[model samples]
Target: MSSFDYNSSMIKAAFFDLDETLINAEHAHKAATEKAFAVFGYDYSEERKKSPNHISMGKRVYDNLKARRDGAGISEEQMPMDKLLDIREGYFLSFMKDEIVLLEGAREILEVMKRKHIITAIVSSGTKKYVELVMDIFKLRNDIHFIITGDDVERGKPDPECYLKAYDQALNELKDLHNQECIVFEDTESGITAGKKAGMRVVYIPTSTSVPPINYLPDYTIGSLLSFKTEVLI
Candidate 1:
C-alpha cells in the first residue's frame, strides 16, 4: 500500500449549500419549474421531470420563452420581463411553502458543529428569500451564523462568488480565524467546485438528483453528514 499525506490543520468555519445539500428540496424546485412552464401554455411531462437534464430546467424554460418572443417565424409576442418574473415567483412560492424538509442527519450535524464552536453559514445559488424561507420552515434560522444567497453576488455556484462572499462573512464573524481554516459542505458539483475555487476544503454529500459525478474529488466525501466524526476535524 502507498502512504498518503494528510493535512493536520483544523477547520474553524463551515459553509453549507442550502438546496439538496442540507435540505432535500429538489422535488419542490421541479414542481415549481413545471408550474412556471405551464404559464407559457407548455405542459411538461413526467418523462421530462425524470430527466437528468432537469437541473437546468428553469433556464431552459426561460430560454424557450425568450425564443418565442424573438419570433423568427414563431408567432408568439415578446413576453414582458415583469410577466416572466411573476410566473417564476408564483411557481416558486406555490411549491416552496411548507414543502421544505431537512435532510437526514442535517440538524444533528449542525448541532455537533455548533457544539465544537465552528462558525456555520449557508452559501447557496438560491435566492435569499427562498433560503430564508427554508431555514425558517426547518427551524434552522437561529442555528446558522450567516447566509450568502444568489442576490448577494453577481454569479451563482461554480463561479466562486457565493462561496467567497460566504467566506468573507465567516471571516468577519470570526475575526481571528484564517481563511484556510474554513471548510464547505456541498451536495452538488457546482457548489463543490465553487468552494474549492474559493480556497476552502469541501465535504461532499450526494443527493438523489442533479448532483454530478465527482470528476474532481472534494477534500472529503461521505454518504451522510452524520458520518462526519469530530475526529476528522481534530
Candidate 2:
C-alpha cells in the first residue's frame, strides 16, 4: 500500500464502489451472465467473467462486452447489444432477489457512516437499474445521498471523470468538502487509480478476484470491509 497518512479530521464525505465492495456479486453475476449468454446464443463460462484479461478489459460490463464482441466481430445486428443487456440485467435482478450475499460488516459500516453524519455516495460502474436493485435489495436507498452510475459519465474508471464529477457535486452539498477532504472506498485497481487521480484518499478493500498490485496500491488496504475500522478515520 502507499505510504500515506490521512488526517482523520480531513474526511468530510466518502464514496463507495457498489459491487464487490459492498456485496458479493460474483455468484449472482455468474447465474445472470450464464443466462444472458444464452440470450446472445453463445456458450458461456464463468471463466469469461473472472479471467484477469476480461476483468481488466473494461470498467463497465457493457463496455467489456462490447470490447469482447467487437473483437470477435459479433455485430449488434446479431446480438442486439442494448436488448441483450436488458435481458442480462433482468436475470441479474431476478437472481439477486432470491439470495443476497452481503459482504462482512457492510451494514455495520454503513450505519457507522450515517451516524457520523458523513456524506456518502455510490460511485459505481454499474447501471442505474442495477445500482437501484442492489440498494433495494440491501434496503439502502437512504444510506447514500448521491449515486453516480456508469450512465452518468462518458468515461469509465481509471479515467477519473466519474470521481471528479462526484467531487464537484460533493462540493455543492457538503461544507468544507474539498478534493482532499473526500475519501473513496474501492475494490478494483481502476477504481483506486480513479480515486487517487481525482485527488481523494482511498481505502482499498480487495475482493478475492480483484486484488491490486502492491506497487500501485491505494493509501490503505484491508482484507475485508469489516476490517476497515472506523475509529481510524474518525
Candidate 3:
C-alpha cells in the first residue's frame, strides 16, 4: 500500500479508465465481442459473457479474443488474433458512437479537475483509435491532457505499465506533481490493481455486480463518479 497522505496533499493529476469508468460501454463491448465471435464461427458462451473475470477486466480486445480462442481450442492459424481483433474493433467502433453514453458525473468530475487546473489523462486498455474516437465523440479531447492506450503500452491493466507511463508523462508535463498526488478513477479490479501498484490512490466504482471479486483493495469505493469531490479526497 502507498503512504500517500490524501488528506494533506492536493490532488495534482487524475487518471481515468475509458470504457466502463468514463462511459457506459460495457454492453457495446460485449456485443462487439459476440459479433466478432460469430464472424469467426465461434460460440461465445453465455456463461463466459455474463461472468466477467477480474484478472481480464481491463485487458485489450486482442487479449480477450485470444483468451476466447484458446478456450474454444481454436488456433491462430485458423482464426488469426489480428484478424479477430480487427473484426472486433470494427464492430465496436461502428456503433460505439451511438451506443456509448457518458456515465453519471463523468463530465462533472472532469470539469472540476479542469477548473482546478489539475492534469487529467485517460489510461485505457482500448486501442488508440478507439479511445480517440470516444474522446472525439464526447468532446473530451480538450478536457483530457493526454492518453495512454493499449497501442502505447506493452502490458495492460493489473501490470501497472499503462498507469506508470501516464504518471511518468504527467510528471514531465506538470510541476510539483508526484505519483502519490495522482488519483486514479477506475471501474475494474485490474485497473485498481494497476493504479495501486503504480503507487497512486485508487477509487473503485464497480459498473457491474457480475464482475468477479477484486483481488486488491482500493483506497475508496464509490457508487458513481457523482459522489466524487476533488476537494475532499479524504
Steric overlap count per candidate: 0, 0, 0
A best-first ranking of the candidates according to their TM-score comes to: 3, 2, 1
CA lDDT of every candidate: 0.69, 0.77, 0.81
Instruction: Assess the local accuracy of residue 43 in candidate 3 as a C-alpha lDDT between 0 and 100.
Output: 64
Better of 1 and 3 by TM-score: 3
Which residue window of length 10 is worst by lDDT in model 2? 49-58
Model 3 Cα lDDT, one tens digit per residue, 18-96:
8888998877888888888888776676535543465356787667667667766677887888888888888989879
Please, what are the lDDT tens digits per residue for candidate 2 over residues 1-234? 443364555577889998888877777776776787787787556435333453442277677666555555567898777887788888888888765677898888888888988788889988888788888878897788889999999989878999998888887887567787788988888888889989888888876667554534587887777777576454
Tens-place lDDT digits, model 1, residues 1-234: 111125557888888887767887667766775676567665554425333452442122344334333432323453464576568767776777666678888999888888888888988767777778888888887689988876787766677888788777777767777656888888767677788888888887776664554555687777787777566453
How accurate locally is residue 87 in candidate 2, as Cα lDDT from 0 to 100?
A: 82
Can you give the lDDT of residue 88 in candidate 3? 87
Compared with the true structure, model 1 gives a TM-score of: 0.81
TM-score of each candidate?
0.81, 0.87, 0.90
Ranked by lDDT, top first: 3, 2, 1
